[model samples]
Target: MGADTITRTNRVTALAPWLLVLPATMAVFALLAVPVGSTLAESFSNPLGVFENYRRFFASDYNRMVVLRSFWIAFATTAIALAAGFFAAYLIAGSGPRTKRILILLSVFPLLTGVVVRSFGWMVILGRNGILNNALIELGLINAPLSLLFNQGAVLVGMVYLFLPLMILSLVGVLETIDQDLYSAAESLGSSPFGVFRQVTFPLALPGMVVGSILVFTGSLATFVTPRLLGGERQMTLATLLHEKAIISFDWEAANTIATIMIVLTALSLVALGMLAKRLSPKGRA
Candidate 1:
């Protein structure tokens, strides 16, 4: 009887927090769940009131390529951002207080600005008459103007620029939490600065890098604003195609299918990251 009573008490304790969370949970169900359910339903629903949209996507090569490009672009963007952000984050982490603050501020400055404004900045920097081409011309580096805008190169640059902040912030959180003693110990044993970083700093920073890469990858995968503004016809990502399907072509079914694929990939990546972290945690502790 006493054990039953204690179980009841624990159940009530758990229920109390859930009761407080009920309203927020209800709102999430209404907002996120409803749209996602609708999309899932639509993905399996045919335009003619049957389930054919999904079949069509799987059957179409053009769509397969478009979706593949989206995933590829996102993967590439994430890798480059992670590589750059890791070094940048490490440099900032080892800096003094004031310098760290300045570096953090500089990292987030791009994120503070509006997306449209950033797109325009890319336009100015990569245009035919842009500063880079003009400087090259003046230096007699090339007789003809180099085309940088409206190409794969422009799309990648813009994607990396936009996604870099997420990487830096993710890395900063993990880097900040690391014990300085580890580095000191490594150095005391005669490890060079770069060697210490390679052995100690890099391993410790892996979790953050993994997290940041996932963020950048997901953002780049579903990227719409940056790619559309920066890329030409050859640079159409899955997101652009989805947008076109929904808005221009009025093909919501195709759009929903694309969205479903993106969601699945993102969820899988997060799950993979979780499993990886679990595997790595024990090694660090041991």
Candidate 2:
């Protein structure tokens, strides 16, 4: 065959598979069409086709509190997880191969326990006469038992412990690719390890940190399991409210409204994070 003809044939073979992805595209659109349609319908409707749903959502203090609590928990968890995960990933990244492997396995520790099982575990350790209290008492750190269960503190601890692995793995993958030669170069040029990390390594790894935080934040925001079991009756996060309204209270309007609010808040958070990431990125032009 002529070389030009052969080249054209090879090019066509490479493009053929991508051309066959039409049905998969259609299926995704089909999957999306239902919920998108339903949400729109619910958002616009009322019991008498009035604007009462939107009004109730905006005016109700309880609903507002639920939304606020959800975001607060999510943001706090994401921030704490990012800080702790970055350091852990740095340690793993700096370690030898065997140690790195062990650290990677340790990253899987959270996955070994189910959310319910983990929540129960937290219940045991954080209860009024919990292990933590007993240890503190034994050490004379506290004069009395501390109430650790059924509140924001318990929720945050569960969340950080639960989703932290994702952040660690994300940062480790990025940090592994970084040039350690850069660190040595900075040190040789009179920069301390801390200075090198602050001025060099961190900016490069910042994108991964942002990604991990976003994932943790979104997951926590959409969380139904942990908060429900851990946060308890007074916590009242949006996800819990959604479940309560949709399933228990059978107020589908309120449930859908809460779901829509969550979607909007998540989208806004991602957009804001993207902007912040861009502003801080060396490669990005302000």
Candidate 3:
């Protein structure tokens, strides 16, 4: 080919991947970037000052409490899901083919149900005169039914139930990739089963744990349905507050401010988890 023709061919080859991805890029920019930009702009558009909305949020003790409570609940949910998921993943990873399939199906079955449905299920189990209370009353555990719903504990239970599958699936994908021979080799070297997990399995599973934790933590932070239903007005969370501001009160500025804060919190959490994952990785230790 002539030099000019060769140059044109080289340009097409170089641009091909971008050309293919152009549609997706445009879709993301339109759907995600535009809304985020608008929300951020609206958040700072308060008449009092640029930082007035943020200042207002911080100045209120109730707002501060809501933010702290949201973070605390998210952290607890992530931790519980990670521990439980790791155990379940390990069991599934070590099982025979048929058993592994069954275990995985069971782990994923909950995800097929709607979050609203699951939250309502929790309400049924936790409400006064509900299944648990009625069963306990029949068994003569208490003189009257104990209150179980509309609390922080109930919210935690709902959040954990909703996000636990994500953690399990993330860990299972990584755990299954690990060589079974590693466990055999560790045993051959006189390492206990627990030592094998600590030294080899856990180290290798760090990436999956990080992925799962991020999913669970971020989801727990942003979830509205479960928290709103289970926690009620007494246990207000940031997500519920944001909804109240935007939909109920029609305070766009406050809603946008909360949304911005949530984005920042979720981003910071991802960064912190990334750093922690690196620190725990075998390569980082080496």
Candidate 4:
């Protein structure tokens, strides 16, 4: 074979992998990059000016409050989900295969149901005239039903319920990967159960916790249905506000602005979580 031919063959072999991924890369660019770019462009192209939408977003106390509230809720949900998922995953990790399978199934079964269905189920449980209230009333717990639905607490409950399963699943994989010998060695070294978990298990599981936190935080920030249903008109997060602007008020410019802000915030948060995870991992520490 000619030297030129061999060089061309080598180039083609190197390019083959890129060619295989070209379609997927194009698909992502089309579906995500293009729309996001368009939205950002439209958000800046308002007749009034580029900064007008942003000024409006921060000028109002209500908008500021809503943005802060959204971050707070996302943080709270991520924390709760991680704590709950870690314990659940630890139990599953230590269990026999049959029990582990059953636990995993139960943990992830809610994911099979649609989000709308799950939100409605929460509505039934949390509504004032719903099942819990009715049962409480029947038991003479209170004369009048306490307002349970259409509030921040209700929204938090729904958010936690929605994201907890994802947290559990993320944690399970990490926990399962941990070596059993490590636990035995720790025990042999006279480490208590709590000490072993605190030093070994928890550190090893930090990556999974970070992954779960990223997922839950991002989802909680952008979730519309749960907040809309459970929080009603009282609480308006960024996602709901974006929906209102685009669909109800027909203000695409403002909607685009909010969307852009959300995208940036989500990206920043995920990056921070990734950095934190790396710092906490054994390899990162090393």
Best by TM-score: 3
lDDT order of candidates, top first: 3, 4, 2, 1
Better of 3 and 4 by TM-score: 3
lDDT of 2 at 256: 76
Residue pairs with colliding backbones in model 1 are 46-50
* Superposed Cα RMSD, model 3: 2.9
lDDT for every model?
A: 0.84, 0.86, 0.92, 0.90
User: What's the C-alpha lDDT at position 214 in model 4?
Assistant: 88
Question: What are the per-model numbers of colliding residue pairs?
Answer: 1, 0, 0, 0
Q: Count backbone overlaps in model 2.
A: 0
**How many clashes in candidate 1?**
1
Error of 4 at 260 (Å): 0.6
Mind giving the per-residue lDDT tens digits that candidate 1 earns over 1-286? Answer: 6999999999999899989999999999999999898997778777565557767887988888777788788888988998898888878877999999999999899999987788778988888898888889999998888888878879889988998988998998889999989888999999999999788877788888778877888778877888888885677888788788899999887888888887888888778767776677647431
Give the 10-residue window scoring lowest on summed lDDT in candidate 4.
277-286
Least accurate 10 contiguous residues by lDDT in model 1:
277-286
Writing each residue's lDDT as its tens digit, candidate 2 over 1-286 gives 9999999999999989987996887777788867766876787677765567878887988777877889899999998999999889989998999999998998887678678887888988998888999999999999999988889999999989888999999899889999978888999999987899899888989888888988998899998888887888789898888899889989888887887778888898888888998989888932
Q: Cα-based RMSD of the predictions, in order?
A: 4.9, 4.8, 2.9, 2.9
- Report the C-alpha lDDT of model 3 over 181-252, residue by residue, as the tens digit: 988999999999889989988888888888999999999999999989999998888899999999999988
Candidate 4 residue-wise lDDT, 97-164, digit = tens: 99999999998789998888999999999788999999999999889999999889999999999999
Candidate 3 backbone collisions, by pair: none
Q: How do these models rank on TM-score, best leading?
A: 3, 4, 2, 1
